[model samples]
Target: MSTEPIDGAALLDEVEAFHRRFNVFPTEAAYVAVTLWDAHAHLLDCFDSTPRLAFLSPEPGSGKTRALEIVEILVPQPMMAVNASAAALFRAASGAEGRPTILFDEIDTVFGPKAGDNEELRGFLNAGHRRSGVTYRCVGDGATQNVVAFPSYCAVAMGGLGHLPDTILTRSVIIRMRRRARNEKVEPFRARVHEKQGHALRDRLARWTEAARPLVDGVFPEMPEGVTDRPADVWEPLIAVADAAGGAWPARARAACLELVNASKTDDKGSIGIRLLTDLRDHVLNGIDRLPTVAILERLHSLDEAPWADMGGKPLDARGLSKLLRQYVTADNEPVAARNIKTGGGVLKGYYAADLSDAWARYCPPPPESPLLPLPPLPASSQP
Candidate 1:
């Protein structure tokens, strides 16, 4: 191996250029931007602790698989698998040289209606992110049988038609892919034609990694303030890799981390069930003992951008509202009880705050604590 320094900026540009030549992924700047760090991840000693890259789409022919193909070209010891059993993956991930960077395609099928068949493989994918992640399985015949510890640490890039399991998605840096538009254009990938150039880039990547590994292993790049917990663990390696790469990569990497992480949060909040509970607790039920359906619906519909207004093919009704609230109740037929809450017309069905308090605490983040003392009304001059 040559001892000369590598041009980190040039190498990063090459990664971005190669990725763009084949596809235009939705949320491209949020996700595709950091894939360069993923490519050269082997340079970091704790690359095993890095998160997996998930390429997800609502439909096929959206360039998801093609992007994984590109990753296979860029990553080290690439193991491209359209389908493989847990046993096969476990054994392959073992042996002398070390973990193979797994490039998995058609990952959605693994969790289809017959998901029971692939739980083992799913477990493997989830556990493979950290160094301590391992699967214990018996090997050899009856007399020789012994439980062997299979190593499950390696970089992974997966492409599929829909979302992965929540556990797996949380551990991944997801790239949402979409069909190309009329104005977009890209080079059609043919393995025979492109593998040569890909191999050349891969070799240079390997050389740079070999020379920079020690330096990268010793450095811990500063994380952005909003990033912490699992988000911090997942983005740390990418940031470190970017820091090693130098130039505009550090800025681009941090921006992608914040953007993608926030996007994931938005996606979670967009779920109807989550929004219902959060809105109920924060806007409708806070400090109140109970609220009738009419009052609840009024408050729900008034909240900005809430889904209740158009839920169930029209405005949310008593039955639909009851059905939604039942998820938090956890008992058969114990939904929003039909208590007669006082109203102008007379009495109507409503929900008691005690019933919802448990669900709110279990599912939602604790609301910001109310101030101990109410501030005096603002002066007329100061009020906007």
Candidate 2:
């Protein structure tokens, strides 16, 4: 860990070296995942966004917690905690100058089913993916009690067994950890020895990031061919880091971005938003000029064994339906806002079929091709 002038590739290499000391990241994607997190941790101020590093494992002894402990030492201004409440995390992130890197270990204990719903924390994590995130909280007492907005932008690294809420996962760069095979071995992480290395590496990374700012600050580095939307957002910083590195790192970074981002997509379950869009296209949008919001809700609720039938123990309503589908189309207003449409019904409002078509084309899967039927009996009498 030298303070002398260093290139981005060398600095990233050092980070990877430090990570490998305590953990055996099962795949190249896994190794790149941690390296990018360490790189992003140091350059948080330079980028508009950063993705949370979610280290999840199927069970304990998967090196998930061990990885977090190591990460706790590498990031700049890390707020490392074995057990921190949502309030503590919010305050820690909001009150910090550069917004601390949150290294939360055993996260499932605080976020799992037994821990009950933590929508606020979930929302907080989700919001932080963008630089514009803010969380409002009521503070003080009596007349002093007024809601204040807190800056929610911060880099988070979390480790746990099993999956987090889908909302949190969507904004994260996930590293699925696993137990090391008998043949694979790593130096046991001793706090005394490892912490010093971690600190030195952090210092080196900090110095390099300061020097490399010009190459990356506010620059939109080119993305891989298929990377777009949220996946593109998640990888922007890493790709920038790779470009700044100026070597084979750029190619490696894109490969890892494509491999891991594609791997994160769930095969068994379809995306909820896409599924909703398909349902609307098939059953609701029938070239009508407009449909009352009430009619849409009724149709959605009529579907058997669907979440809309009894969403949250209450039938899905217009407002709820709007919220789910809102991300696809324009807001209540806008030309492509890119999908807002007319709504009306005396005191109630409706939606235009034209507005929904754009969302259908973008979000819905293609309908299956109709099978051709054999021509009817070839006019049997004519053949005779």
TM-score per candidate = 0.77, 0.73
Candidate 1, run of 10 with poorest lDDT:
329-338
Check candidate 1 and list the clashing pairs.
none
lDDT of candidate 2?
0.78
Best-matching candidate per lDDT: 2
lDDT of 1 by residue, 59-120 (tens): 88888888888878887888988777878787778768777888889988787544534779
Clashing residue pairs for model 2: 330-339, 336-339, 343-350, 344-350
User: How high is the lDDT of residue 127 in model 2?
Assistant: 79
Lowest lDDT sum, 10 consecutive residues, model 2, at 331-340
Estimate every model's Cα lDDT from 0 to 1. Answer: 0.76, 0.78
